[model samples]
Target: MGPIGGKSKLKEAAVGFALGAVGGCILGATEDPVDKIVSVMTTSGSLKPVMDEVRAVGALGLGTLIGATALTTAMTSVIAGVILAAVVASMFVAMRSCTGSHEHSVGLWASAGFAGAIGTTLSGASFGIVVELIVKNYGMVGLLWALSFFTVLKPPLRFVFKVLWKQGEICCTPGSEVRSREREHIEITDWQQRQRVTLQIEQRILSLEKGGSTSGIEGRTMWATQQKEREELERRKLENEEAEMAQRSIQDWINTVMVKHVDFLAFSGIPMAIVAIVTSGFGLFGYGGHQSVFLVLLALVGLLGYFLLKSSDFKFWMLVGCMGMFAIFVIGMLTLHAGQVVVTTAVKMRAAGRNLSREQISTAMNYQSSLEAVKTAFFGAKLCQLGLGATVGGALVRRSAGDVKVIAGAASVAGSLLAGLEVLAPALGDGGTAGALLGVVGATGVSVGATAATAGRWSSWPGTLGTIGGLLIGALGMGKWHIVNIGLQLPVAYVFAMINPF
Candidate 1:
């Protein structure tokens, strides 16, 4: 849909605000240790000490391996970070894609879940093994392996998915397959582009009305369709046993993009930080020293957001820009806290007559907390972003309701404020307690009201309620007793993903 004629921007903003508040709650409920870990893994060093411990234990069995990964610097290099991110993202996509409504007892999408999980697990293991075998060196070997694996696996995975989906139609569900045709990638353009494209089409139609032979632009569109995409689509159909392939979903694309972005930020953070320092008058007035650094980083973040937007998809960019800022800020906070730890430890060592340097203390402390570092760096923003995206997605499902778009402007402001609170809640010392309450209650209330306000297939609200509870319970379990956040977060993400917001 074109941005101008659709729902008013106000309603959209309100939806985002509501979702952001829920996200704030999720952040508040989760342990701060997540942040602490991110601080430790900022460096480029390999996890030598952690690997040594792993090897000493003899074999990488499940329990021991899990503990080791949980306790160690499992992914310290850039390649390792990308690999780890990709594995989780791919697995997440698979898990969420399962449980679809096909004709069979089991659905095609659902059946493919295991294949995706297995593939991701093997990828994770291969990443670790390759890193270990290569001595965790920084080079193209790791990158090549990762790229090769991802590229090589797509066709087979698609084929498997097709087979499963076909069988699922026959075996699993009460009805025939129910695939949403809205699975295509969203493409929106500015008014100018829209008008130009319309003019082109209308002109061609006029020529056809006059019985003119198809020759110029009209022929090109037909020619290109025949020349490229049609053939490709047909081949893919043959391979996948389907009429079409869903374009990579927005959620999946963003997940994959962010990992690549982490690589960009790894190099960009320093130069950007330096610029912030100089521009802030050395923290004389602008943003509060560290905050100033992050503020400058936000500029870069926004730039990336603009690129990701890739066009005049204003609404998409707004949420994504905010998310980019959130990601950079979270990473920056970890780095700041790590600096404090290094200084504190060095000071303590000097007092104890050990005389350790700041560099050495920083390095040792970083090694000690590599687990959290990997967690925060690789996996943190993804969950929050997912939650936020899905929550705002409520408005999408309710778009057919009368006068809803008119509320988007006000909603945008509210959403922005809530988003601010979500991102800055940690600074208040209450771990975003207030924000969390608002998010949970607000999101719950919004979803309910939105469902009542609309008259279409808006069954997504019920699952969202469960998702809120999941966030709370999962965060509590993980924070209090060291339960895996994934146990809860994954299901929540699955719900988020399953909702065809468009």
Candidate 2:
């Protein structure tokens, strides 16, 4: 059984690793939005003639990516809050059972979720604002200093915030609290009645004793029963008090540690973005000294790991190590891909009996590279839309107790449609057109899946308002529709939340 359990745990770990890898790739592809947008615009017939449009688009993309990064951090925070709340809730329930208490007065989920939402929102907002005001305006100088700021200050800040902000407030739902109070009142009244009855039995026993009658024995029996009942009530009250104390301790500990973990994740994006910018800059320059960059990064990671090890912060170490390794891996892959693309283009030109001039080959490579950012942005937006739809579908399922089969069917159909549309991408003759088609299909899939999941929910006011709000925030306000940044920052956030790297 032990070996089997070990194997099962290993299998789960492998699955998680694979997910992390794929997610990292998706995020890495979307980094350096400003450069990518410029590249895409350079290739466009209309936008190429208008530099202002290109600059505006680039800024918009950058802002959107940053905001999406904030959203990803927020989501991870929510995940941490939910998981911590669940564990604490389970602990409290066990303690309650030991006290022979069956009352479900605790509304841990609502309180935890609310607190998490507020904290996460504030953290994201503050982080985003600081990055924009301080780091972004200075360009490369900003990136350099920002990197140092996050690496040095973030960990201590996480601890400080955890100590300062209580993530989990042990609050009951309003209705449940009212019900619990009423039950307590009834118990108090019953105890008072029991006390009165015991006093009456005592008086009767005394009277019987005075009368020197056999009825005194019956009165003694009644008095003994009343005493036993009173002792039982006293024992229950003591157990209740103990249970309450235990719950308070658990809540405090959870709030301290778990909230710190969330803060740690919430602040990770800035550093991740800085890393992406540095790597992407190297990519633009053909990375003549890429090895040096890798070595420097590895050394920094090692230094941090040493500190983490000294502190016995295994989780944080793991998160940092995982991120460092993946960044190296993805950077290596992109470098190889760029080389391969240049070689492939040259080979095709030669095969077609055309002279592969250095200038022509460079032009081709540059054009191809330029399209990457546009593709990444479009793909990122589509993914965010799909995720939003899935989230809504999941909620509807929970509320309606709906069949999972229908949702599954809708997703499968959407997947098939996406696969079919993929074949038409090259035929579109332009990378931007192909990417736009992908987004359209994704939006359509979201609509179909959401409606199929729960038509009633889709038609409701909450649903309508949510849809409009999402559109306005993701599309209109951002100049492109996206919720999560499909970039290096997201994977970092996820790993921190999942592994609790603090």
In the predicted model 2, the residue pairs found to clash are 27-486, 27-487, 316-501
**Which lDDT value does model 1 have at 409?**
25
What TM-score against the true fold does each predicted structure earn? Answer: 0.34, 0.44
Q: Which lDDT tens digits does candidate 2 get at residues 1-502?
A: 9998666655544433332222222222222332243344346552232222212222222222222332333333333433444354544443343432222242443333233323322332344345334422454235334544554565676666455443323343233344356458658967796779978868768978898555668868977887787787776667666555654544454444455444544453433444444443443355423466555545544564455456554454244433433333343334335434876979987999977888766555443433433333333333433343233233323333232332333334333434543464344333333333333322222233333233233434444333323322322223232334433223222222222222
Residue ranges of candidate 1 with Cα displaced over 4 Å: 1-46, 49-110, 127-135, 139-298, 306-311, 314-329, 348-354, 357-359, 365-372, 381-502
lDDT of 1 at 403: 20
For candidate 1, write residues 445-490 as lDDT tens digits. Answer: 2232233233223234433443344344433553464446545444
In candidate 2, which residue ranges exceed 4 Å CA deviation?
Answer: 1-106, 110-153, 166-214, 217-221, 224-232, 242-246, 249-253, 256-263, 266-313, 328-332, 347-502
